[model samples]
Structure formats: structure tokens, C-alpha cells
Target chain A: MIRPIHAIQIFLIVAVITLVGNWVGMQQINPVDAALGMLILVAMVMAGWWLARVLPVPFPPIVFVSLLGILLTMPWTPGSEWIVSHTTQVNFLATTTPVLAFAGISIGKDLDKFAELGWRIIVVALVVFTGTFLGSAVIAQAMLRLTGQI
Target chain B: MAENEVVEREFEHNWKLYGIVLILTIIGELIGVRTFQVGPGTALLLPMLYALVIGMFLGPKFVKVVSEKDMSDASPLIVLSVLILVAKLGTTIGPNVPQLIGAGPALLMQEFGNLGTLILAMPVAVLLGFKREAIGATFSNAREGALAIIGDVYGLDSPEGRGVLGVYICGTIFGAIYNGIMSGFIASLNIFHPMAIGMASGVGSASMMSAAGGAAAAAIPEAADTILTFAAASNLVTSATGLYMMIFISIPLANLYLRILTGGRE
Candidate 1:
């Protein structure tokens, strides 16, 4: 687990990257609104991280962060409109860019190990990814069609 | 090999790592979202892809500009950074709670679709002559949760553990790229509704889900909100319950399936 301070620091840095991405890649949102939205998300994430640590159980911080997000933004919740509108300033894709960029940077360490796995695991990996994604999509499509919701 | 050891790297927190990432992100964002038609489906290339692909080139293997320790240091940050995306996706769910409720059954059951890995990958792995490793590789998408599960059950030094770790690295290395392209292509095919593809996007990793969900939505922009809502809801379901399901359901089923497919030869 990341120390809360380190997590917060990283979150702030990532939020800046995401803000630029949102403005350049997605839309030209006001920097103030975007930064405010990122700060709110960072606070929620830190709160969730703190809760996960202090709590007796061993639940992941992400579960708490997600629940907090959902609860705060629900229609009946107080100030949900502000939460929703501010958060809307942060595009989902924009937030993900930094994460994947970090992911790509970290892949070098695994290259040797990955090379040793050879062709078979690569084939299997591709298959597993394809199967899991396509299977769920197929099932959901059928179910939605059956439920008359599609 | 332990999960904690992987995540708890020395907290050097170098500036170069952050600097390179910022530059790559800016370049990627400037390129923005681009699309080209491919046969029936259209390929939607987002800034995320550009960042990832270019960042790969800057890795130690390709460019040697960054050291091995720098890469290790960045590992934990990836998991930490992803929380922002997870929280953002969660916010998408609040307004669409009713739509999520209406599609509840499909949302819940589509997780079983995760078991498709066992059905499809297990046979190929078995025929490829893997033994215990087949069980680890095919049991799940082999995310961090799967890594913990396999480590707990088989010890990370074991063959089964290596199998899961291999898949984990595979996911780490290329999962998002695959999801980005595949989700867009599948969405463009028009056989399945965008909502269904959204539900499918939650394959247990934040980056994969983000790429898959974002790409699918881009392919069908009219239904972007609906698609993203379902993706987030389904992904939350995966994050919360996916572990128990893997422990009680996926692992055992993969073991049994592998046994049958190998005809007890191993």
C-alpha cells in the first residue's frame, strides 16, 4: 500500500496531467473547474484510502472510493448536482492517460520475464483477453435482448 | 514474488519518472482522438494509446533512458494512480442508477462471462502441453487479485504461481492496448449493443476497463453515457465480488476443466 502522503502527492501530479489531457485531448474546460474536480476526486480517494487503513476489515481502498463516489453523486444526495457537474469537467479518458503512461514505463522491467514465457503464453494471453471480453459482451447482449432492454 | 513486495517498492519517488510521463501525456493529448475505418469496424485511437505506446519506447529495454529501478518505482504508482479513474467511473454510475438497476440481471450475470477464459483458453493451454500452469493462466484474467489468489493457494515460487504471474505481466504489458483496439472493433461491428460491450469492459483491471469502455463509447458516441455507466457499474461489481467468485468458482472450474481436457495425462 502507498503511504497516504505519497498517494496524495501522486494524485495531485496525475490530476495536473489529466487536466491538460482533458483540455487538449477532450475539451477546453475551464482550468479552475477541472482542478476543482480533480481535487474533489483526490480527496475522495484519500478519504477512502484512510478508511481502508483504519478500518478493521481488509477491503481495498478502491471499493470505498467507488462507494463514496456513488453515494455522493446520487440524485437524492445533498450537493450532488455540484459534485456531478464539477466531476463532469474531468473526462474519464483524460484521467486514464497518465495511468497507462505509467503502465507503459513500468513494462521494461518485465520484458526479460515476458520474453522467457515465449510464444505460447502470448497466444494464450491474447485468447484469454478475447474470450473474457467477447463472452461477457455476448451474454449481456442476449440477456438485454431477452429482457427487452436493448 | 509476493504481491506486497511487487507493490511496496522502495519509495524513491523520482522526478524523472514524473517528468517523462508528463511530456508523453502532453504529446499524446495533442494528437487527441483519431479514427479510421477498418473493414466493418472503426479503430478509435485515443491519447491514452499514444501515451502508452510512446512510453514503452522510453522504457529501459527500448531506449535505456530510464533505469530498472525507475521502472520498479513506477509500478506501485500505476495502481495508486488508477484510483482516480475508478472514482471517476463510479461518479458516472450515480446519475444512471436507475438504468443500472433496470439492467441489473445482465450486469450480475455478465460476470460469469469472465469464466469464458477457462472455457476457451484452458483447452488451448492444455493442448499446448502445460500442466499446473494451465490452471493458473486460464482461471481468470490474472489481475492483481488473481495474483494474490494464486500466490496464496500455490505459493509464488511454484509452477502454478508462475503461470498466473505470466498472465499478470501480459496484462500489465499489453492488456490496455488490446482492450482499446478490440473494444472499438467489436463495438463497430454492430452485432451487440453498446451497453453490452460496456458491461463486458469490466474485465477486472482499471486500465483495461478504461480503454475498453472508452474505446467502445467512442465507437458509438451517441450512446457514450449509457455505455460508460454500464462499464463502471459492471467493473465495480467485478472489483467487489470478483475475488470470491474466483476462489469458489473460477479456480476450481478451471482445474476441473484442465483435468478433463488433459485426460489426466499430467
Candidate 2:
């Protein structure tokens, strides 16, 4: 069993790995600015964590932070420029590689449970994906026509 | 105090666990990244699919190199990375405000895709004799949003709760793949507006949304940044509305369908 960890430890571990990922792909990053950028991300994460805690609903931390970032960084907003400037140094693509990697590994954890559900689950999954795809396509087709953009 | 020492020791252990995840993530990411650099036909090698495939095959069921516990421990790292990416994606929205405004209701169309699925699939699931439990899985959204609603309405011990869990697991795995395919397929069609298609990529899951939108943007280089931002916003909308849709709309509608199928039988 994994040991229970302090929130600060989790924060440190995330921050360190993220910074390393950023550094690996970032060309000519100033170490000081890079560290500052990492801190900003940490603050954002903490802010999201705080919101998820206080909210009555089961809000996801990542979405909350993303929305908060979007609001503060809108071009007309006061700190938008600072956010835009610093985030550029973070190499967003570099972060995605790790995120997707972890997502894959994480989703696999439930395979046994998923497999136990039987073959019907596969059929259901197929139908669901088909519906979502065709539904999205139909809606997009209509919207595009209404906008006269197509 | 002795308690502080114990906590510190735990922190050290967590660090080690987290480190193992980072190493695996790097390997998965490297493979995924390399696929992007390959020839034109091989553009399918986005990190989303590649990394996931790596994780699934190399996970506990196979090589046993990456355990479920490791995945769980590293979840926070993945979440953090996603936040940063989403935030970065958000920052790009500044320049595309007008295009985003133009996306209009299309940004939300994908979330309703489930409604269409429920309408079509409910009858079939019912015919197949899906229990009230499987109906919850079959009819509802089956994501995090649907779990509490389904469980609350029918109780976790009820078939509805179990059904939702089954579908949720399947959805989590397959949803990502679907998003990747849809993005590329939508982009290739050319009949759909790139912006509109981008808006449709926001199917609630952040990583899936990112994967779909990223593929669209990569395929349509002219509107790359705009597509990313638009999809990100659309994802936000889906999540905000997801809970309500799952409860008031999807659940009631599901029950009605089931009732109609069984001649009003509970």
C-alpha cells in the first residue's frame, strides 16, 4: 500500500515533474523564469483545489482552474498579458505528453472491472460512440449552415 | 513530535512512487511524440492514443511494470499537467474571441450527443433485457456527472448504480479513443466548419476534448489556435451543464423509456 502523503509533498512532486517536462521541450528557458512559471501553475492548482473544496457540487479541480485562468487571462482583463507571457514559456505540448501518458495508465487500472462486465459492454460502447459522433455531426451541420460559414 | 517524523517518512515514500510514474509517463510520451514526426499517413500517433496504448499494454495485466497503485499515485501529476495545458489552451483564446463568439450553440451540440444515443440505444438495451441497473448505464451519460445522480435516484445497491459504473468505466476508456477519431474524421470531411467541428470536440472529458480539438487544429493549420480555444470553452460548457443533464433530463427520460418498454412495469 502507498503511504499517505502531505498535500505539500504532492504539490512538490507535481511541480518538479511538470518543470522537468517543460524544460525537456522548452528551448532557451531562463531557469529563474521557468521556476516562476512553475510557481504560477502551482498557485493555479491550489486555487482550483480550494474552489473544488468550497463548492457545493463535485466540481473537478482542473476545470475550475482552467475556467479561472480563462477569466483572468481574457484579453480585456488586467492580468491577461502576464498570463499569456508566462504560459508561453511553459511549452503546453510538453505537458500534454505526460498528461495523456498518465491518463492511459490510469484508465487501464479498471480493466479487470471493465472486463467483468461482459461482451455487452462492448456493444454499448460502440453504440454510444456512434450516437455521439453522428449527433455531433448532425448538430454541427445545422449550426454551420445557420452561420452560413460552410 | 513523533507524528511529524511519520508524516515525513510517508512523504518520502509518496515521492518515490510518484517518481516511478514520471519515468513511465516520459517513456509513453516519447513514443507518442515520435509518431507525430513520422510520415504523413502516420499523423495518427498523437500522444493521447499512443500514451494510452502504452499504458494499457504495459500495465498490471501484462508486463506488470506499471501497477494500478502507481497509476493512482500519479493521478495528481496527470491532473496538474492537464490543468496547465488547459490553462495554456485558455490563454490562446484571447485572439480568437470573435471566432469563438461565432461558434454559438455548436459548441454545446456534442454534449447533447448523449441524448441522441439514449433515444436510439435505450430500446435496444431494453429489448436485450438489461436490468434496471444496466438501464442506468445504458441510458445515462455514465461519466462522473451521472454516477451520483444515478446512485442517488435509485440507490447504489440498485441495478441503476451498478449499470452506471459499468458504462462509466467503458466510457472512460473508449471516450478518449472516440474523441481522437472524431477530431480527425471531422477535420478531414471539409464539409463542416473547422470552428464548428472544434466546438463539437468538447464532449466533457478534458483529455478527450483536448485530443479531439488538438487533432482538428493540427489538421487544419489555418485555425489551429482558434480551434484549441473554442474546444476548451466548449468542454467547460459541457461540464457545467453535464450534471443537470444527467439528473433532471437524462434520468427522467430514461425511466420513461424503460416504463414504455415494460408496459408500465417497475
Highest TM-score against the true fold, candidate: 1
TM-score (all chains, Cα) for each model: 0.69, 0.58
List the candidate 2 regions with Cα displacement exceeding 4 Å.
A1-5, A25-35, A55-58, A97-111, A114-126, A140-150, B1-13, B32-43, B47-89, B92-98, B105-266
Query: For model 1, how does the per-residue alpha-carbon lDDT over A69-111 read when each residue is reduced to its tens digit?
Result: 7878888899988999999989887887887677667655655
Which regions in candidate 1 have their CA more than 4 angstroms from the true location?
A: A115-126, A129-150, B2-10, B104-107, B125-266
For model 2, name the residue pairs that clash: B133-B159, B133-B160
Residue B155 Cα positional deviation in candidate 2, in Å, after optimal superposition = 18
Q: For model 1, which pairs clash?
A: none
User: Who wins the lDDT comparison?
Assistant: 1
- Residues B1-266, candidate 1: write the lDDT tens digits: 32366555545567898988888888989998776655433446667777866766676658887887677666666666777876887687676665556657889889889988889998888877678888888899987557545644654344675577677667766778788788989999999988899999988777789889998999999999988888888887776567668877997798788778878775
Q: Cα lDDT for residue A86, model 1? A: 94
Here the TM-score of candidate 1's chain B is: 0.64
Deviation from truth (RMSD, Å), model 2: 8.2
Mark the 10 consecutive residues where model 1 chain B has the least summed lDDT.
B1-10
